[model samples]
Target: MATHKRAETLMDSVCEDMEEKPEPYFSFGIIADIQYADIDNGYNFMKTRMRYYRNSLTLLKEAVQEWDSESTKPKFILQLGDIIDGFNVPQKTSDTSLAIILAEMEKLKIPFHHIWGNHEFYNFKRKYLMESKLNSKPLEDEIGQLTINEDTSETRSDQESFYGYHFSPYPGFRFLLIDCYDLSVIGRDTMSIKYGMSLKLLKEKNPNEDLNSPRGLEEEQFVQFNGGVSGAQLNWINSVLASSDEQDEKVVVIGHLPIHLDSTDAICLAWNYKEILSALQSHPCVIGYFAGHDHDGGYSVDASGIHHITFKGVIETPPENQAFGTMYMYEDKMVLKGRGLVLSKTLHYRNGRKEEPVH
Candidate 1:
């Protein structure tokens, strides 16, 4: 609870400084893990995540509208990932959830971009949907006239669907919506990680068992991950960053997973947070990395000036699932803002008693 207060103070401090700045600035909203549409048998099924998240969205919309009523709203809105627990549920359920979220985002009237989460693959591998290896035809055959630009299409329906990373024409900043999960083919190393015990040991451990048994690990903890940016996707990310560097653009990398964990300093190399940090450190254009997945709120700073932030989850139940927000680069000082919303009254009381209230 005391922790939540600190988070709120962080947000307020950031907001206050922005207000004091002489130059006009833009601010946007990010919502994470609104795993909408689970009828039953799941944590946030049957629109439970949606119910709480819609409220948060409403609050955010009102705030943005009140702040910028006369002109265009902040450059855009970003839905970080786990928009739906697609990997764990039926395709229709997840798709419907995505549709609802898309509708809500549309009401904001800003260009919204979505990042792919591990769940968006209908509880399957992300690599399958990345390249054009899948069986489906292009969007023209499936959803005709739904696409706005055919010539500028970055999406390949036959492969994994990518909403494309979005960028603002706004000065001094760029947002990269990275597709960390590859859905085309499973690599040998990735298979090893997914299986946990390693391929060599698989035969030794289950000598008499079938070659492709359940692998003894539960579905929830399945690996099926490639980890860091590698191969073609890595090249793409580098190219994108290089282009941004050429233009002297300040970048804020947004993804679903945390670059570093607050509980432990373990760095997951598969996603390349460390490598990404190292690469972005020399560039004045790279400000920070914003992400979710840990559901805990904290900021980590390496030897370099770059900042990595893990945002709280929106669908976490009363005591554990409380939601929050953070602001960066809102002013000259790059103050950070944090806030706690939809908390349990008991938890609030416990937290409130521990902290000094802002005047």
Candidate 2:
């Protein structure tokens, strides 16, 4: 009886110590859906409220200034896509609009990682977007390329741009950025294999003549605006996770589309979220999933204790309001300090066996 009581007392003391303070390993800045345009303010399809398309540039500048002024300074900035608005000016002027936004990001003087969203596809082809805009070098150079499977000798050559990339700012920590539009209708030629596959899926899953409409679709995620992970991409992700697991490294996945159903609107989820989640479940290295698509934003922890955070869009913020955040990563938890319209959250880390999916 005495030994059991002492053990309980020791456990309680350890638990109390763990709750005392947070110790971050590293940190980074995160912003989503800047959607900057040179056009006047306009309303969305529903006309609920006006979208401050032009004002988003000011917001981006402010966010960069804030991030640059941080005492510890974030290692890098992660832009969650839609940097340039789809409705920006004439089609011929869209590229220039994109260049303006890119120039703003360059002022920070820190490495900026970008994920491609649907709206970006509205302006350029995947090859041009990836090779010329996003990537630091041409695709042929294939800098930092990873082998998907050692047994099959398959290399990830085509994905040099936005397909997927992993980075480690510190030992025992990794960030995986996924391109959710790999299999989407946007950015791919109609005659391409991926476009054909996307079309077939749309035909079988969505019966509406307007594929973008969610009216008759049983699954909210079947809409055309959303995209899925390709089989090759999935294999690459699994390989990376497996490698991370072997190294005992913790991972934070950043995608333009939400991977968890409850983390955002159903229509904003990735089409192959289930498959992606299943892949993530098999590897206990993933600690958090961050994304931006549904402007309202959401947060939820799965049964495995992995956090799913959908960042609010900067485009939706009215004048004087803002949306952006910085994530401080620690060994046992992550702290998100939100500014403007974004909400702060504390997510505890859990590294263990997989559990049932969170609704």
Model 1 C-alpha lDDT per residue in residues 1-359, reported as the tens digit of each score: 99999999999999999876655356565566655544443333324342443343344444345434635355555566666554325445544555555566566565545665545544434444343222111211132212222322233432323333536435656676655543212322244332333334334433434432335632211233323343344445566666666666566777665554442223221244555455555455556676665544456654444556666656453422335442434434344334454221110001101122111
RMSD of each: 12.7, 6.2
Q: Taking the tens digit of each residue's C-alpha lDDT, what string does model 2 give over 198-259?
A: 88887788899888888867787888888988886788888988888878888888889998
Candidate 2 Cα misplacement greater than 4 A, ranges: 1-23, 89-91, 136-162, 356-359
After superposing candidate 1 on the true structure, give the runs of residues whose Cα lies further than 4 Å from its correct spot.
1-20, 38-72, 87-92, 123-166, 183-222, 225-227, 261-272, 317-331, 341-359
lDDT score, candidate 1, position 177: 61
**Candidate 2 Cα lDDT to native:** 0.81
- What is candidate 2's TM-score against the reference? 0.88
Q: Which candidate is the best by TM-score?
A: 2
